[model samples]
Target: MITAIVHIDVEADRIPEVAAQVAELPGVTEAYSTTGDVDIIAVVRVAQHDMLADVIADRVSKVSGVVRTRTYIAFQAYSQHDLEAAFALGLDD
Candidate 1:
């Protein structure tokens, strides 16, 4: 799966409305109203890279009250348990 973090900016009065709309999009897993430079953060998962444009450009950007968006693609993930799991699986300490 291809995962992306989309930071969304929306009309000040439409944060909740825009977040709800974005969350309903096919590829979006979740959307949150956040406190920071961006108003909302959306997690999007797609089967292919090209689908990103379809979900973000062709759809998300057109949502009513959405001002703009910035997308960041994830390359890897690390967690506290990853090391423990690797060790248990026989990785040499």
Candidate 2:
């Protein structure tokens, strides 16, 4: 699966509306309203790489209140257990 982390900016009054709209898109698995430089964060997952443009460009960017978006493609995913094991590797007693 291909995963993308999208940081979205939206009109001040439309954060909730835009988040909901983004979450409903086909490839978007989750959308959250957040505090910081960006107003919303969306998690997009698709079976193929080419589908990213279709989801992010064709769908997400067109949401009514979306002002802008920055996308990050994930190269690897590490679980909490994986992180712990890696850290413990050199600490064996």
Q: How close is candidate 1 to the true structure, as a TM-score?
A: 0.85
- Give per-residue CA lDDT, model 2, range 1-93, as digits (tens): 999999999999999889998999999999999988999999999999999999999999999999999999999998999898888997858
Candidate-wise lDDT, in order: 0.94, 0.95
Instruction: Work out the TM-score per prediction.
Output: 0.85, 0.85
Q: Which pairs clash in the backbone of model 1?
A: none
CA lDDT of 8 in candidate 2?
Answer: 95
Clashing pairs in 2: none
Q: Which stretches of candidate 2 lie over 4 Å from their true place?
A: 81-93
